[model samples]
Target: MTTKSLSIPLDFPFPSPKAHPLLTLHSKIQFPCKFPLFSLPQRIQFLRNQCPPKCQNPNDNNNPVPYTSQQEAHFTETQEAISQFLQEFGISAAESNSIALNSPKYAKMLFDSVKDLEEWTSWKSGGDGNEFATLGFKEKVAYMAKEKGDNGKVAFLESLGLSLSSSMNVARYLHGESLPNLIHKVKYMKEILFSDSDDKRLVGKYARCMMMNLSIPIDEDLQQTLSLFEKVEARRGGLDMLGSSEVTFRCLVESFPRILLLPLDLHLKPMVEFLDSVGVPKEHMREIFLLFPPVIICDITGINRKVQALKKVWAFDKDFGKMLLKYPWILSTAIQKNYKEIVSFFHMEKVDKSSVDTAIRSWPHILGCSTSKLEVMVEQLAKLGIRNKKLGQVISKSPQLLLRKPQEFLQVVLFLEDLGFDRETVGQVASRCPEIFAASIEKTLKKKIEFLDRIGVSKDHLPRVIKKYPELLVSDVNRTILPRMKYLKDVGLSKKDIAFMVRRFSPLLGYSIEEVLRPKYEFLVNTMKKPVEDVVGYPRYFSYSLEKKIMPRFWVLKGRNIECSLKDMLAKNDEEFAADFMGF
Candidate 1:
């Protein structure tokens, strides 16, 4: 018990045997224990091993560690803050993971900052990196940063490793509510995504979403934006991006049909016409065409059909035909939609299957009535013995017959035959009958041939007529009329003889005395240089003013300029000077 203590060596290799047993036990427990020390792994193994045994006892209430109030408060506060932030930014917290999350300004900020963390964590967790896959850690971080009210800070994070998230947010801005801001933002993102090869998926997704969200009736600015995207895609071969996005592709496909239907923009006019001419495949056209308002479709088709029907009837009507042709599409549309209107156009009282048949049978004989009436005539012809083919031949042979009264001419022919006349005799009798010829024939003949020196009927056709109807005109005045007129005029017959000749021959020549005399007077005025106004006794001097001044001035102004020498320009030729001045 004496203080015979010894100092232990600092570097002692082993414990002293002389040490107290209790001390030895303590030492063994503290440092020199030989059994395997319980490591974290071993502790986990022990816990796992004891779990089954502990679980078997049942009734052991091992409630999950209850959350502390502080922790709970923290979580609650965080959630509340997030809710308020979303509301402040006009976004829905319920749409947290939706694309809509990127649309709002606040949502974009959050998405940019927190999306990265989410993306990284997602990637670490074995996400496939597909756009549809869960976001990674980086994405989550970006989203969180955005939510924490640090949009500018989130943008800085994007520079680090969250470029895709940033680009996606920008694209959302473009498509979502902040379209104006998004437009500018998209330009920057477009450069980043397109410049880098690794972020193509993100770029594609952004482009697709932007296209989908664009308004249908785009303005010039938006159109330019679209054009830019199109150019980029074309140059970069990234159209697959648009194609992959269902929303975007569907919008584009719908555009053609919309344009075809309404054509709001005049720019689409030529395109529509071209499509019509080339004709979209029936199957494809039908699919899109069906989307048009029914009334619009009816109107377009009706107009086209009316035009075609009018052309068919009026092709031989010359001036009338030309007028109808000018509005072919309109006429066709009327005919297609309203058969009654088309028939009425020709002055037909009613249009039915019979009317249509008659119209077709009449072929080239639609000149007399309005187009609608002509259609009825054709219908009637079809009902008669005339087949379409025979009718066509007849129409071609005697196109002039369309101008005649159908019943009157038919009666004349029949009457001549009943009077023991042959076909030639019937033709002659029909030609002589006033009602069998068009009322305008005299005026038309006078206008067509200005002067006629000889006034005798041709022996060629006349002999045939005389041989068939020798009893009709037994008087020699019908044969020697021209010579008799000359003799009468020479022997003091004066204007009376000339008038008599005109009246006698008017029916034969298909003209009136007045029509023939007017041209003769015009010819005399032209040859003598006496003003037509003076000779014809026009009291207003209107004719004199028109002929001597207005007409000459008009001719000078309207006529084409001769590429003559300067001599002509300086000469008395007022016409040349006027033409030169007008650049004619």
Candidate 2:
């Protein structure tokens, strides 16, 4: 229900009847004595008895003068009620009258005192219904919370000028999660909520729902936020898309709470439709919407261009579908513009098309980097006397080089060069596993090197270990390396067997036990009838794309009565694989 603002007059003997139970301090008059609650007729009789001769009824001398205006009538009736109510509270009629008006100086003070109590009573009783009379203040609050829910309670508390934390405390206390201490705080908040004229929105139930449901507070900031929202909503096709129902409107607010304050036509619509047009599919749209709501409302044309370039220009494999599911924010990056330039720059540097595509598919963001950022480092490598085809090989093998600052790569190269490594040997080490350059000296690389040293990989054999798999320097001792080593031990590989595997194919340590190694090992042993030790003889087989290449080819071969070993089955490219298995 909507409550209108109380427009009580200065001379009115009583506060306005429509006044909220929460209003306090009528400025014009005050009553010294406490006033009792009285019925309407008793109030009228008291008014007639207190009527001055000049203000008395002229035609019917028995009745108080009929008020010429409603304000005067209400004033008369309220004055009478105040007089009788004071008398009922054990205030002598004479003393009440004296306090009511005897001293002209105290008249306003008396009237104010009377008005304050009346306002308090009205709020507590809630007028005609007196719904709050049976409940204490906190109980009343709890009742409101129970009946109206958190949103409603929140609106009520906000109107009171209480902080949200205080309201939450009250809720927690009621739920036995907190102790009570916030009564005075609640009162202070109530005063702030009710007395502030700027917050008229707190008066009506509908307006309260609008603010509460969306967690908006009534304030000057709200006005600005909502003003922008309305402007956006009214844009060319915005209103048509947003529609008119409050339910749908609230749903939008719930889904993207911050969208209300964002620009609509320019920021929200274009990127949303771009994703839709590019086959992002309807089911995954919510994940995109909720995770990156601002995507629909971003300067995302660059990101869109990247997606377009991947499909049209770069001829990126149809793996984009899975990439979106894995990295929804990829479409929000401003990388495509730089990516195109970098790819072309790489082509000029003798990086082959197949190599560039392979590197990009493995690390899609490589194309997003600007070539200029890496030119100094590439030039420095050429200065190291590794140029042309060799330089292309270095970059293709470690496209992550583009991601690092030039100084980072320069330092790593210089650090490797100081370690008595020749230029060619340094390039081979970096190309095999560029992540070593980024691995921490004190934290990651030193710790892993110590572990390998204890495993009997002598300092002489260390270079061979690194040459076999540079990724070992970056692999976690506890999380990746130790766990995989533990799994191999659990599968009956001794320290010697493990060291031999690490020396031959250290890439095996990079595959996760849970995600890659264990599952593939179980599949080969149980389904393909391969022995576990034979599987361990070639741990590199675990690194193959199990779902994409291994399983599909295995199932096809099983159907065709083909008995190829695991290596022959998974080693071929898709075309060679199809030709071998299906005789295409």
Winner by lDDT: 2
Q: Which stretches of candidate 2 lie over 4 Å from their true place?
A: 1-258, 261-294, 298-310, 322-334, 357-361, 364-368, 380-397, 414-420, 469-471, 475-584
Give the range of the ten consecutive residues with the poorest summed lDDT in model 1: 26-35
Cα error, candidate 1, residue 11 (Å): 96
For 300-333, candidate 1 gives per-residue lDDT tens digits of 4544454355546544223333232221122222
In candidate 2, how many Å is residue 179 off?
Answer: 36
TM-score, structure 2 vs. true: 0.40
lDDT for residue 417 in candidate 2, whole number 0-100: 62
lDDT of 2 by residue, 392-508 (tens): 666666655556666766777776565457678876776666667655566776677778878766566676677767788877677778888888888777888788777767777
